[model samples]
Target: MDTPSYRERLNRVLRYIENHLDDSPDLEALSAVACFSPYHFHRIFSAMVGESVAAYVRRLRLERAAMQLSLSDVTITQVALAAGYDSLDAFSRAFRAQFKVLPSAYRRNDGPLEQARRYSIGQPLFYHLAPDVPPIDVQIRSFAPMWVATLRYTGPYDDCYPAWETLMAAMQTQGLLTVDTFACAVSHDNPDITPVDKCRMEVCLSLPPGMTANTLAVRNLLQDKRIYLRVIGSNSDYAVIEVNGPYSLLHPAYRSLYWQWLPQSGREPDDDPGFEVYYNSPQSTEPQDLRTGIFIPLLMG
Candidate 1:
């Protein structure tokens, strides 16, 4: 099947899920939305989206609940019930597991990043959050569609650096690395929602135009290494911010963008996962000197 066709079907499924979050749509109904068979839908959904259907729905529900808690005056029980939990105790347990705070506490706190700091005490990376974080500078930028070769790692975000090394080495051996190559990291799971041990990160390098997964050279290289080639489509409007410190700062930067800027900016984030473009190698550059660009896609009118 053509890649675009597959993507189109899955995108439809995503929209369907978002609009019907409270319904708790069954697998058969979701599969029909994507025009896929019930037996194969779960596997395809997980493979294409990087998470199972149930997990995706649950995360979206909790995320919505979080927005309501932070942005509105909704009661704890009401928020819990809206998130699909039958009991307040069950919702509180789930919320605390995801956000590290009970619904009431999260509502009272300044933001999720602030709450995360309490649990991360004594960690150097988290120390930056102690001081009041300055307002992040965001630029609206457009990006071109590009192809990237990626290596997927399933583990703690801190431990995924080796995956980048392995991917870069493999690409270099194939003579794919060049002066114009771009390196990026795609985070598939939110640390607050997914367990740290189960987080997924895809270390990626942009391939030169005309290089793709179907290329004979790339196909042969993938025979041994667990690498994937996919296209990142263009977006005319992306809320881009530059981070110029240790990687730990990225979490707060994102929090500021979503929790602080987004509501006031009059822009809505698209469903696509945001990605980070690294400008320098952490191995060579000092943590304070490293630079990264965070790109969050915006929904089109």
Candidate 2:
């Protein structure tokens, strides 16, 4: 499975430092909570938590200071010193920066809720989604490499089939492709910023071995990191219809295989090719249509 979000780790680290405030803490000590090396601790903490580790420590101390100021008869000077400030003036300066209120005002009516609320802000692959798609067996095999006359375009995925057809038409005269040929779409753009118009999809054919780039009349298929998954059963079957036709819209599919079958199958996606090859065949004589099996590259232990 992929790593969990950095934010989750940051939250845990924050909880640890906040809870251990009574003990005088050091950077090396706090970094242990995050599992980062001591050398880069400050940078990682700052990047994930949006503040220096020291600043986070300072704010938390003030947050507790605000609480202590309200609940007890402790004077402002004592609360400041207890919260790790050397003097009342220093504590006051830091407190007003974060809470927009001085120690004096906050002690009168301390609010922890408002400060913590700020941290709560907001912050796809093919074969990976199998298993809920039960009976799916996407294997990573050494695909005998082939050459393809290729076409590249960036558009909505629904718009891909047409672009593929254009490539087919352009290469048909050259006999580069034929009926029941395997068609592959290489994903080129990152999911972020490629949601619609910016998303890049490529239609390609495997080229013969020893062929140079110029041999492809159009352009050669660009090798890319991808996932391949095999879709089983005939297209009309409910399970086979997992990939929606153009009319429907859904997510890129959940990575249920990683969640379940991986431990069961003891397999993982291949790292180098980074693709799943789906295997399928035409069970009927339909123009430009046939069965498809998704093949994703995998590394099985």
Candidate 3:
């Protein structure tokens, strides 16, 4: 298969593993999901992902358990059980090894929970248990209301690119993508809190004055009153990241924004959903050269 097709298949496997962390399917099932023989699947998965499938699943489970421990009032045992551990002792050992703190201590104070690196559609999408933390520069600003043509995707954020492709095609057919066109992604749900299959995001483009098309739904993005931290080259209030590469790598940037930057920034999340603005066209630029501005909304005084 071609590279993009291959990455898509690999992403499917990753999504399945994440969505079913509580009881992920067996190796045989995963092989089938990847559409490869068990032996071939194992080798390819390790080479492309930099870890064994079992290892990846274990890490993801522990990571989810850590999120629950830090974010919710759930008991350690409950979090352990939900993370597919049969005994708290076993869970504690694994969690400590991965995060360097016991689950209970992590619950009381989340300062020590190591931030996990997110995966994407590139070759060798390795899991970095201890990736270096990058510095974030945030600019707060108020954005005017924008009229946009959007296509909404209600599933795993990783799976939203197809919706974007469709939206772009519809726009092209309707002659909407002109030189002045501006594109953005609107994410309505937090992936940590929302089920993977139920997350909502909109692929949007700025609508020319009085332009209308049946294929695209229109939305008014109004944040005139609140301030946003604009990063990634957008103009709005929220945590932002200027990411360059395939859209898949954007996940890690978001994880850093929420888990690392927000706590240090002293700002709180606003009521509006987070969104992204695209600065380069995917069709015209190399995947590695694509620049996207990710805008996260925050409450401001």
Candidate 4:
């Protein structure tokens, strides 16, 4: 199948899976969603996505269950049922197999509840925030609502190039990208907590105002009044350093900011999801010379 057509069909099925996680979608139903024959869909999905459809669904369920455990005060039994497990024992076994951490322990120690409350309060305060180090620059800027054309990719970060290529081609065909065009990647899951195979990422290009997308998967990102305590430094905000390197090195930079910088900075993360704005294209720029700016949305004290 062609790239755009394949991405459209596969993205549709993936979105369907996300929207209906509690409901088990059989191979025939998934194949119908992908518009491929049942046998053909199974082989093609595994080959292209690097995991079988059943495995993919189960992983998503378990990972989401983990997220709920860490982020919410929901009971283990309720979480298990929401994850489509019949019993807490089965969910516990599956969670342990995947994460090697028990559900209860995960909730008490490393969950969002623990991280935010503990890190901000007593003992864990000394862990990463270093006031001796220079402050990180963060800009609080407002932006007009952006109309974007997007393609969702549901696999490893490295596997996202195909989706970008597909989206770019569609943009070029529709005459969307121009001198003022902005490009960004929207990350939907935290890699530390979510499995790489199940991570959701989108390659997006800003579209002209009032432009209508021909594809079903296109979405609008409205940020009219959205406020961000951005980590990309300026004279008024905190200090930010530019890192020109492979994308894999980004995690360390994030660690430095959150652990090494955030505590001393007196800022907390906002609800808005952080994203990367690409200043240079990977297709033309070498990995070593790539220029990408990482922005973490935050709340200033």
TM-score for candidate 3: 0.50
Could you tell me every candidate's TM-score relative to the true structure? 0.68, 0.37, 0.50, 0.63
Q: Which tens-of-lDDT digit does each residue in 134-176 have in candidate 3? A: 3444556556567676554568987777877776666666566
Question: Once superposed on the true structure, which residue ranges of model 3 sit more than 4 Å away at CA?
Answer: 1-134, 192-195, 210-236
Compared with the true structure, the alpha-carbon lDDT of candidate 1 equals: 0.77
Q: Write the per-residue lDDT of candidate 1 for residues 105-130, one digit (tens) a residue.
A: 77776446445445445643223443
Model 1 quality (TM-score): 0.68
Question: Compared with the true structure, what per-residue lDDT tens digits does model 2 show for residues 61-156?
Answer: 665676566435579999989888888888899878866889887655444322222322331122332223333343333444444544555578
Worst 10 residues of 4 by lDDT: 222-231
**Candidate 2, lDDT over the whole model:** 0.49
lDDT of each residue in 149-242, candidate 4, tens digit only? 6666666877799877776666665565577777877676767677777688867777765555443223222111111111222222223344
Indicate the worst ten consecutive residues by lDDT in candidate 3: 220-229
| Candidates sorted on lDDT, descending | 1, 4, 3, 2
Q: Rank candidates, TM-score, best first.
A: 1, 4, 3, 2
Count of clashes in candidate 4? 6
Q: Which stretches of candidate 2 lie over 4 Å from their true place?
A: 1-135, 138-140, 188-194, 208-254, 272-290
